[model samples]
Every structure is written in structure tokens, then in C-alpha cells.
Target: MAAPATATILSDEEKAVFAELRNEHEKHRSVMIKMDRYYEGVQRLEHIGLAVPPELRRFETVVNLPRIAVDEVERRLDVKSLMLPDDQIANEDLRVGWEYNDLDAQAPQAHKEAMIFGRSFVTVGSNEEDPDQPLMTVESPRHMSVKIDNRRRQMTAALRQYIDPERKTDSATLYLPNTTIWLTRDNGSRWNVTDRDDHNIGRVPVVMFLNRQRTGSWFGTSEMHDVLPLTDAIARSLTNLQIAAETHSVPQKYVLGMTKGDFVDKNGDPIPVWESYFSGIWAHANKDAKVGQFSPSDLKNFHDTVNHYMALAAAITGLPVRYMGQQTVNPAAEGAIRADEARLVKNTERKQVSFGASWGWSMSLRERFRTGEFPRNGRIRLEWYDAGTPTMAQRSDSIQKLSGGTPILSREGAWDELGWSEARKARERQYFLAQESDPYFQRIQEKEELNDPSILRDPVQEPDHA
Candidate 1:
């Protein structure tokens, strides 16, 4: 009776739908695999916990480096207010945009939160009569956090290299800038805020290393008509000098202002005057007549223009410029001062070990290795030595106590009855009995003196009471 279901021969439309579904499924599966890998890594580390071996940890804080005067550093960098041709400026912007996009593609999770606003805004210099405007007026307020990819890994790598004890390196290395979002409203608003409810527009500091061991740099592009012409410019036109001091080998107490009030006074003034710094990366400023959608060619043209400007700037400065802000250090350490920071203190704890020459031993403790939590318990081994004049065979006579384990935790009631010390003594008694079957160690009396000198001569003697 139905119009004889017109021969449903797997229509092209249905095939297309099936194809789309397949693509989506593949994407989701890939994402799931990646997430699984990430979780597995986290689980592995979490099981290990934060309890690092004493041998691997540096409990001591070393020397502190003096903060560089912001004004002085800015003067040295010499930020220019140069304006480039319109076409060139547009190209630079698009190039930076592409790089940023590439960055996003690589780390979709983190880069999604990034803010790229300056590509549309322009900063001009003073003097309306002058034809050229400023590139960008950079205001350095003491310190700032700039964004970077894999920020934590980058910082840790730098710290590891800088503080390698084997190398005995003392000089502080400059860190790439940790960039924060800097925005302007319309054309004449403050270069800080972006939202109404969010009034703390200055800068949101990102916490990575507690110490000021990292630095940040930001890059952008502007048009020639929007900034100054630097060809005829002199060194003094925009230089602001400040002093940088280095202290001697002494650990000084330097406070990093974590709270806003620490850096801002009641009168709303900055506590320390930072050296202002300004610099630009290569960028292209395209002004195409057509106002429709931009084509891939348009983007490519902009990228090329930016590369050109970056090359020019790098040549003039004789330093790698454009979109890089790697922290630097002076190899000579001429201006550096030495100061001792902190020292490490060692603590001692008494742990028990069993002696079993040519015999097997086992020690066990309750342990739970969770996916995202610390381990419940752990165990270690000690080599029991031969009672005779120390020889390699005597050293090899020890049996690992952890080979077969013991429950670290016991019922509170059972613990109360046995007492922890009594329980430990019981384990020692069992361990001694295990060696009874082996004639070589059978005569090693339970109450006899051990080879280790640390063993007490008198059992009743109390160790340092503390």
C-alpha cells in the first residue's frame, strides 16, 4: 500500500552521511587515545608520589641575584617607534597570526585559552605634525608574565642547566618572557582590561617558579604610517637608562611580591620603577581593496611581509629578534654579586634490618599504588654482612627483606597489644629462625654482636634521646 518503498538502493545521500559519521568517529577516537596516554603518564608519576630520595634532592637554597633595573634594560633593548609600509605591516601581522595558529594546533588544549588582540590595534607616537607614528608604546610595569608553549618544561630545563651543581654555574640566566594578555579598548583606552567585571586590568601574574628566574617577551606588527621612521633616529631618542647590580656569594632574603598590594602602594603608586622596554617582531600590514573573505593567498602574503621586517630588525640589532625571547646570561659574570641563600640540614631516623648469611629473608608492608594518589607504604633492603673480618662474600651473604613482604599496617587493637617495638622484635626473631636451617649462619646467635659498628654494644643503651 505504501508507494512501494521506491527501491532504496543505498542512496548517495546516505553514503555521504555515513562518511561524515566515520570521520567524526575517527577524530573522537584519536582524541581519546591521546587523553589515555596523558592519563597513564600522570598515573605513573602519581604512584611515585612527591617523596623524593634524599640523595636526589637539594634542600639548600643557593645565592640570590639582584633584580635588573627595568629602565636600564629597556634602554639597552631600545624599542623603536618605526612605521613600515601598509602592505608590509599587514603581512607581518598575518605571519604572526599563522605562527600563533600553528602553536594552537600543536597544543589545542592550552592554546585555546590564548588571547591574540594586538594584531588589530595600533600604537602611534607623539607629535601629530610628524608624518610617522610609533610602532607600539610598551609600558614595563616592574614585571610581567608573557605566554609561551610548554612553559613549565621550558622553565625547568633552564633551571636545571643553570643550577647544575657539577658545573658549579652561579650566574643567573634571563628567561624567555611569560606573556599575559594585554588589550586596549577602541583606540584610546587603557592597555590593560578587557572585561567589565574584571577590573584588575594591569596584568595577571602567572605562577611557575617561585623565584624570579624567568623573563618574558611579546611580539607584534604595525604599519609604517602608524609608527616612526628609525633610519634617521639616534640612540638617545628613546633610551631610558637604569643600573643593574650583582651581589656577592651570600644568600639574601628577596621577597617576590605575590599580592597586588605588595607591588602597589596605598597612594596607588608602583613600589619599584621598572625599566620600560619596547621592541617589535616582523609583520605585514595588508590593505586589500576587496572587503570580502580573505583567501589563503592573502594570509601567505602577510606572512612573507612579516619575515622581511624580522630579517631587517635582526640585522640591525645583531641579535636574534622577531618572535623569540630566550633568557640570556653573561658568561663572564662581571656584574654579578655572590650571596648565600640557604643551607640544607640533615635528620637521622633509625630503621631495622635483618642479618641472614647464606639464608633467604622476606619483608612486606601494606601498599596501595593508586592512579592519582600517593602510595600507602613502601619498603627498602639492606645487605647483611658476615660477622667475620669484612669480605665480599660476607657482604653478599645478605638477603633482601622485601623479597617476601610483611604488612606495614596492623589492626589498632593488635598494635596496642603487641606494641610496635615488640612487633619489630618478633620479625627479627622470625628472620633469625629462617637462618637456623643454614648451618653457616645457625651459630650466629640471636643475641650476638653484629658486624655493623652502628649496632649497640649494650642493648639497653638509649640512642640520642631526641
Candidate 2:
């Protein structure tokens, strides 16, 4: 067969299509470059930790916490259940300090009514430092009432939920809440009313935990009664565990096993250790040790406790123990970011458009979009007056002004036309510019859309079908 004839000619449309494709490829390459740069910047900020200056430190830390915890906490709490109830009552009348109030005022009336119903409010407590040590006494409200029986009941219920059924420990037998707070009002003028204060405020248990071990285990320790020390010790131990988990180089399972049980070698053999030499990993402040009294005692104990755990895990796992860097933002970038941020903000003499609205407007030609509501046409709309449609003026003005009176350029519609330009090309560029100029603003729009674009649509009424 004769060799295929050489291709002769291409249509104008085909040429345009090829050119468009080329342009798209170039756009994609440019985007990838920018994204790579952005990712590198983020990685540098993350891995370098607080190497960034003061202002950015908080930004970095706040973002990192939840991202790191997401995989960890997902199983612990069903996130949906943690949401506060819709009708949850907030005691708005309560203030941190005493405020002079008129008897006729709504808040005073509410407070009086609550008092009549035996509802107590939280009061600002005094913080008095212990003269000799780095300790402070924090006093709770003197007028508050607590129900000990009710609290114990709730604690028992919670215990039952998590406890093993076969090995049920009697919650009461395990040393349940025993601590109580007795409160009395100090209304000097109303002696009779004040006299009944103690009666109105019932004693409530201060909850605490106990550490229990198996019967044969040499590690079984007696149940201590102090609530504060127990809490402190537990908190310290948890902190130590957190530090170890953070520093460990091996898999999470290995680190967890090291903490909960005994550390094992690579061969799955438990390291035999004598019980006598292994002291408890935590210590509490001794009341007898004053600040001036120096034997390098309690502080040393605390420091040693933290350091010992950290060092042990680090040595075992071969992970470096790194100190937290100073919290500070980059001085050089602060001024520039701030300036760009301010420019990104729009200052109006009249009503101010929010960043969200500005972003949506920037992304589309929908000038009639207000905020919330949906129309029957099935587009996420922002406006109520025009029902998400662009005004005629908007369409005309946009086409003329944006197209710059160029005869060769194609004009889709006047700017006011609702959803006039749904073309992917224009929107991509618009959103891309938005992302480059303000990552935060871009993130908000992306998040809103992700959650539900129609969420902002106004609720509509339906005609009765019957």
C-alpha cells in the first residue's frame, strides 16, 4: 500500500482547540510550581517548629495540634456527640466579679428568681500565694451549692459504662467521691436569710481517681485519699507519657507497649527487671519543703521525673529529645503579610462586606447573592431581592468594562445576568488568584463549599400539592 498521504490542513476550530490545550498545560505546570513552593514553605514551617518568630508560632502551633490529634482522637470520641446542645442554657446573668445592679433590671430579677429556685452562680475567687512555696490557694465560691449524692450517682453510671462486666469492682468499695464543700452566704444585713445559706447549699463530692493493680502483682499500691496529689501525680504521669509518645522513633504500638507494660527487645523477649530498683516514675510537691529551704528536693524530683522518662524513652527508641523553641513570629515577613492582608481587606464608608461575601463575589458574577437562601432554579444563591440573579446593569457593565470594547474578544452576557459566566476557565483563574493572594480566604470558601454550598441558600416555601 502507498504510504499514508501527508496530512494537509487543519480547521480554524482545531487550531484554536490545540492552542487552548497548550494554554491549559502551561497553566497546570505553573500551578504545580506554585503549589510545590507553597508546600515547601509549609513543610519548612512545620518541621522547623518554633524556629519561626513569635507571631507565627501561635498560628503554627494551633494548626499542628488538631492535625496531629485527628488520627489519634478519632476513635476516642464520636465527634458528633461532643457538640453542645442547641437549647443549652448559658447563665448570662453571672459575672466574674460583683456588679452593681438595679433591682428592677432583668438580670437582677433573673438572679433573684434563680436564688429563689436554689440556683447558685459562680463567683470570682481570690488567688493567694503560699508564703513559702511556689503554691497558690484558689478558693471556690462561698455561696455555691453542690449535690454530692447526685454526683456520685453520675460517676457510678460512668464507671459502669467502661468497666469490664466480669470483674466489676464495687464503685463504692473503690473509694468513690468523699470530699464535700460546705458553703454559707455572708449577707450581713439579712441575718435570717444568711442563716439558711448553709441549708440551701448542699455538700457535693469532689471527684478523684484511684490506681488499682492485680492481687499477686508486687506493684499493688494502697489507695491514697488526697484528691489534689492524686490528680497532680496522674497529670504528671500523663504528661510524661505524652512526651515519650512524642519522642519515640519506633512504631506507636511499641511506644505504647513500653509505657503500659514492660519494654521488649526486637526479638519479642521481655526485658527482665528487678522490682526493687524500679521506683514510681512520678512525685508530688512536699508541703514541708519551703522555697528558701534548699536540698534540691521537690523541684529536683519534678525535673528528674520528667527528664528520666523522656531520656529513657529517647535512649531506647533512639529518638532525640528536643526542647520547645521560643514562641515568636518572623519579623521580616510580619510587615509584608500584614500589608497584603490589609489590602485584601475592603474598607467601606457604608455597610462593610465580610471577607466571605467578598470572596464569593470575587469568584463569580453573582452580585445579587446576599448570604442565606436558595431559589427553585437549584443554584446556591446569595441575594434575596433578585433571587441570586445578576442585575442587568451588572451584566452589561461587566461585559463592556471587562472586555474593554475589543471586537475580537467574545462577550458571553451583560454582567447583571444571573450565573452568566459558569465557564471553568474564568472561575479557575479567579479562584487561583484568590488562593495566591489570601490562602485563608481561599480556605474559607473551599471549606464552605465543601460543607455545603447550598447551606447558605435561603429556605424556600413549597406549594401544597394536594
Candidate 3:
């Protein structure tokens, strides 16, 4: 309920941090422009279609074909299957609160959109009137700044900027160490000196969403960067494709040779070489008069080149070649389909691990909202769906083997491992438990557990049940 980071003045060091942050923010804005262009399928003719040559314009009109945007495919392919899919937030009370905050529906969508900009943040705090349900909202990095301690070991302060449309002014909130507002500035200049103290993480109340982070760096890179060069290449290919189509479709004209004597006499009389020399429809009195037909050769070459680049884009961005919509092939085997997406699956898993931490931190912040405590715990984790899944077989052999091999593993856990939905798993678990509840099945299961040597191994430690 209390405001943090409200102050009228800033220290010299704090001013320096703001100066550096503003500079870095400019770079982020530039990158976002490029990323947005690709994400929205707005690959431009800005560079490739600029100037037109006079000769080519005479033969075939150049047309801009649909831009083959690799950015959205790459970004989506990386995050689409990266759903946390975890039961971590299945707490009954928190479920209501998550829905109350609209985070249940929007979290996944916001996370993907944030990845496009390379970073996002979630601000978790509470309103005085609604103390029971803490408020949490996702924030774009463009509107926020965070300053960490010199060692980079801890973040001590944060600032949020807002532009008031009605007032047509910029306002800033500089929050500090004690969950207190250190500074409040209204309608300030861009170069205005920026306005930190808290080790209490909850007091900061901002959790950063950073994924696909490169080593030795704090910033994350989007898939747009991975295939940025390919966007131009793909655009060039499509443009050439249009040129080829136009060239092959347009008419070509030529003339056949005839006797020159028919052109004129020695008296300088104007004469036509043929009955209709320039008539467009040629006719000759003493020679052949026909329009020559032109066959456009090697038109396939243009399309072939385009297809090659599209393939390259697919490979670089981990998008399936089928997404290019070029050729038709028979349905692929399950293994082959999985192979095509192997790179994508790996990328998605990496995102899950990275964003999992961020989500877990957000959950922690959500708790901080409910309780006045800065943090409930230092350790947190999120469960993620398995990579390379959506198997054709709902109940796999490996799942059966797992159940038979580990008596300690719950039936529901085994089902979940096979990528079964919670609802399906619940139904299957109930059916199995009902069947196994009989004395006969229970006696058989006991005998099997007793026969397992791993369970009898000298003082075997209890394995953690999934």
C-alpha cells in the first residue's frame, strides 16, 4: 500500500546509472524496431525494391511478393511448445487470485510478446482497497529500468516511466531499498538526472523475464537476430520470383526477313516491306507473315533459388521445411516429424528452463503481495512439459516400462511423464486405482514390489516420487 522510490533529488552515482541505462535503452529500441518488422510479417522493400532499372521496367513490371518473415516463425517455434504446463500454481487459493489478476490467461501470451522485445518484467504489488488479492501485472521493458549493485550480485532499485496522454507529459517513479518512493518527477526532460537501498527483494517487486541469455551477458537475444540476414535474402528471392512470373506471362514480338525490293523503287516512293510491316498483325505479299512465339526458358530457376533460400531460413530458424508451403509430401513418420523439430524442441526446452526461473520468481512476488514478507523463500522451481512430445501413441511402451520398473512412481506421474493432460491423467488414475483397489491386484503389486531387488538393496534410500 506504501509507495517506494519517491524522492526529489538524485545522487551523482545514481545519475550516472540512469545515463548508462538510457544509452542501452536506445539500443534496445533500435533492435525492437527490426524485430517488430519481422514479427509482424512486415519484411520491407525498403532496401531491395528501392530503384527501378529502365530496361527491366519495359519488359516486365516488378512486383513485391509476400515477405517470408522468418522472425515470427523462429520466435514462435522457440516458445510455442515451451508452456510451463506445470501443476506448481494449482493451489486453490492462488488459482482464484491468478484469475482475479487475469494472469492465468494472459501470462503465456505476454511471455511470448515479451520475448520478441528480448526482455519483459512483471510488477507485483497490492492495492490498499483490495488487500486480499494482491495485484500483479506484466510490464514492458521499455517503460521500466532496474539498477543492480556494483557487484551485480543484487538489484537495489527500480524506476518506471509513464506518459500521460491527456496531460501530454512524462512522469517517473524511482523506487528504493526500503519499499519507499525515493523520487517523483512530472513532465521531466529526457536528460533529467535519474534517481536506490533494499536487499528485500519483494520491496523491489519487479521480476525480469529474460530467456535465451547468452553467456557473460545480461540481455537476451530474439530469434529475429538469428535469421535477420535471411529476411532480406528471402525478400530478394520473392521479388525475383515475381519478376520471373511477369516475364513468362508477357508477350514477346519478333519479325521475319523479306526482300528489300518491296520496300521502295528508285523514284523514292514510300513502300512497306510487307503488306503490314508495322501493323502489329504482320502480312506479306511474297513472303511468310506470322507472329513469332517466344517460349520462356529457365523460369523454374527463379523458383528453385527461392526454395533454396527458404530452406536455409528454415534450417537457421529451426522452422520445419513444410512451413514454407512449397512442395507436397506424404505424411511423415512420428520419428521423422520429431527429427524435423529436434532443434526447435531443444530451443524450447532452454526457454522453459530460463523462463521457469522467472515465473517461479513471479510466484514468489505473488506471495510477497499476499504477505508483507519480502520473500517467503530463496529457492523456487517450475515444472515444464517434456521436449519432443505430442506423441502419436497416447500410452507409450516406455511409460509402461517406467511404471513396472519403479514401484514408487505414481501412476499419475508416469502418465504425466508420457505427456498426458492433467484431466486425462486424473481419469486414468481413477480407473486404475479403482481396478487396483481389489485385494487380488493389491496382492500382486505387493509381490512385484517385494521381488524388485532395488527396493531391497541394503538400506535403499527412498527415491523422490514424481
Candidate 4:
């Protein structure tokens, strides 16, 4: 059953607070939306408009470098598990909630949005139907905004807005530390409090996932902002190249003394310019007419210019040239490829650290929603897969060497390094324990050990006692 909507009204101060937060949210909404358009390959051709004729505007093309830049980093991030030291139950509880939320699929989406729009949000609340599993949702910055308390380094307030075109209503949920105010407006009506919830969590449930945040800034900087101009340039160059191919791919022909009337078909109707140009045969009664051709324009320069901007974009975004569709005569060696990815891998690790914190905070809120109190004993730590590109064989070899003869790494540590999920690790542990306890298997192992010539040669020796 759904929880009944409370009829609590908002006070004047609460209304003003919501208004302020909503206004702040409005200020960033447009910018975030524009970035989203760029990331989606739907941004209007800004530089191509002047060069491209209006009729050829349909030939405009987008290189989609923003998506490439953001996705390249986003794909490297994957959360393995959330850890609570010495608290297996708490860890398992968080894992259950994490899976219940389908964060494996949702997290990458949030990361991409954060990369494109500077930041994204994750909201946690109670699931009335399943009390054990809290409801967690990934929210885009387009419809959400947050205010952080710099000293505390926490979100003090957040506002999430919604629009219902079918119903012609606008709704918003203002999340405060002590109370949540739900406001609604019908058509052009004034905002009215429709519902409220006072959970008194003492902290806003919304957690912001920042991307490339500066030292002193609360919000993050969009990853696409730096390469947007290059993307435009590439798009413009490609559009111009297409237009040139259409208009000048064939050599131009001129008739010095022939008029339009002279270019006529057998029926005496004037031939269209395109038909006459492509017909390959021409005849005129005027003996003074002279025909000549201009060589077709070489499009190599346009292609080279596009490649130039692509290289600049790759450099600025830490992406390999090949990622931008630049092909080389010789393929890059394995070591060289890894070296090229060093900067991108390091950047991905930084994002994992930053975004991991927000995910951990959101899970903590999930725990609070589940138990009505936060876990005070151990801290929540999110475990992420290694952001580098190492083959499975390489990872296995490294794990074996690290775990072989020294106490440098443990079994669990090896499993973590292998990026195995907790469930798989647990299952493997169960199988190992079961095999060790099997009597038949132990008897067969003992028979083989007794038959071994080395064991016979090194027969057991009893210790001497006084």
C-alpha cells in the first residue's frame, strides 16, 4: 500500500527557502540542458551555420566527441561492493540494498550525467513495500539542485522539480535537514503545499556526484565544456566537406558563348542545369561557343583540418587519437597503447574516488532508512574495480606473484584484486570448505599421498621425548 500523503502546510519561511533553492536550481538548469544536448549529439551546428548554405543545412554532422570523451571515462568505473570493516551483516545489508537499487546499471548513467552536466544526484528514501530494502534513485542535474555547507562538507538542502504536461501541473520536493516540503502548482496558480514529511534525518538525503570539481567550488565542472569548441569545429569542417563533395566533386564545365536557350532537349524544352552538366554530351549551333572544364577541388585539406581539431580534442580530453576515429598506418603496440591510456586511467581513478564517496553517502542514507539510525561503529567504504586496462591473464599473474610466498596479500585481497563479486567469492569459499570436509575426497587424497614415492622416501619421523 502507498503511504498516505500528509496534509501538513508549509510556513512562510519554508516557502521562501524553497523559492530560493528553486531559483538557484533554475540558474544551472539551462546550462546543464545545453551540455546534455552536446553529449547526445543533438546540439545545433553553431559554426556550420554561416558556412553551410541554408539548403545544405541538412548535411550538418556531429562528431559526437563529447559522448566519446565522457563514455570513455564512465565505462572504466564499476563499483564492486560497499564494505563495513568487521561488520559483515552491515556490509551484506548494504549489498542487498545496492543490488535492490540496480546500481550496477544506474551508476554508470549517473556518472555519464555528472561528466556531461558537472554533477548528478542520488536520492535515498524508504520503500514502504519492502522495509528491508530502501528505494534509491539516480537523478539528473537537469531537474535537481543542491546547496552544500562548505564547513561541514555536506548537503544542507536540495530541491527536485517535476513537470506533468498531461496534467498541466508543476511539482517540486524541497528536501531540508529536518523536513521535506512538497509543493505543487496547477497551470498559472501559485505554489501550494500538497504534502510534507518530517523524518528529521538531520541531513539532506540527496548526495551529489561531482566530476572534476575544483578546489574551492561546491559544484563540479563539466568534462565536455573543454572540448565543446573542438567538437563544433570538427562538425563544421565535416559539414563543409560534405557540401563541397556535393557541389564540386565533379569538374565544373563552362560554355563561353552558349545561352540557356541553347541548352535544350529534342522537344525544345530548356534542359535543367544539373541534367545538362551530368549529360556528358553537348552541342550548340553557335560556332563561337567554347567549352572548358575546371579541375575538381581536392577535399584532402578539409579532412586534414577535421583531423587537426580531433587531435586537439583528444589531447585536451586525455583520449587516444584512435578513440577519435583517427587511423594510423601502423597499429599502436600494446605497451604504447597502455602508455597512451595512462592519463585517462589516472583520471578515471580520480573520478572513482570522488563518485565513490557520493555512492557511499547514499548507501549510508539507505542504512538509515532501513534501521532508523546510522551505523556508528564502522565507516562505509565503496570498493571499485581497477580503472586500468590489464588483461585477465596479467591480473592473474600479478595476483599469484603477490600472494605466493609472502604475507603481502591475503586470499580475500586476491579475490578483490580479481574484481570478483562478494556473492561469487562467498560461493567459492563455500565450495572450498565443502571439499575439505568431504570424507571420500579426503580418503582419495590420502591414498594418492601414501602411494607417492616422495612421501614414502620421506616417511614420517617421531620426535624423541625425555
> What's each prediction's clash count?
55, 24, 15, 0
Instruction: List residue ranges in candidate 3 displaced over 4 A.
Output: 3-20, 48-90, 165-168, 180-203, 255-290, 374-377, 392-395, 401-466
Please give the lDDT score at residue 383 for candidate 2. 22
Give per-model TM-scores: 0.13, 0.15, 0.68, 0.86
- Winner by lDDT: 4
Top-TM-score structure, candidate number: 4
List, residue by residue over 268-368, the lDDT tens digit for candidate 3: 46465453355523543545644575866566676777678667767776767776665488336777777777877777776776776777667666666
Which is superior by lDDT, 2 or 4? 4
User: Once model 1 is optimally superposed onto the true structure by TM-score, how far is the C-alpha of residue 61 displaced, in angstroms?
Assistant: 22
Q: Judged by lDDT relative to the true structure, which candidate is superior, 2 or 3?
A: 3
Identify the superior model by lDDT, candidate 1 or candidate 3: 3
Q: Quantify all predictions' global Cα lDDT against the true fold.
A: 0.24, 0.26, 0.58, 0.80
For each of the candidates, the C-alpha root-mean-square deviation to the true structure, in angstroms, is 34.6, 35.1, 10.7, 4.7
Count residue pairs with overlapping backbones in model 1: 55
- Model 3 whole-model lDDT (C-alpha atoms): 0.58
Which residue segments of model 1 deviate by more than 4 Å?
A: 1-24, 27-41, 44-86, 91-466
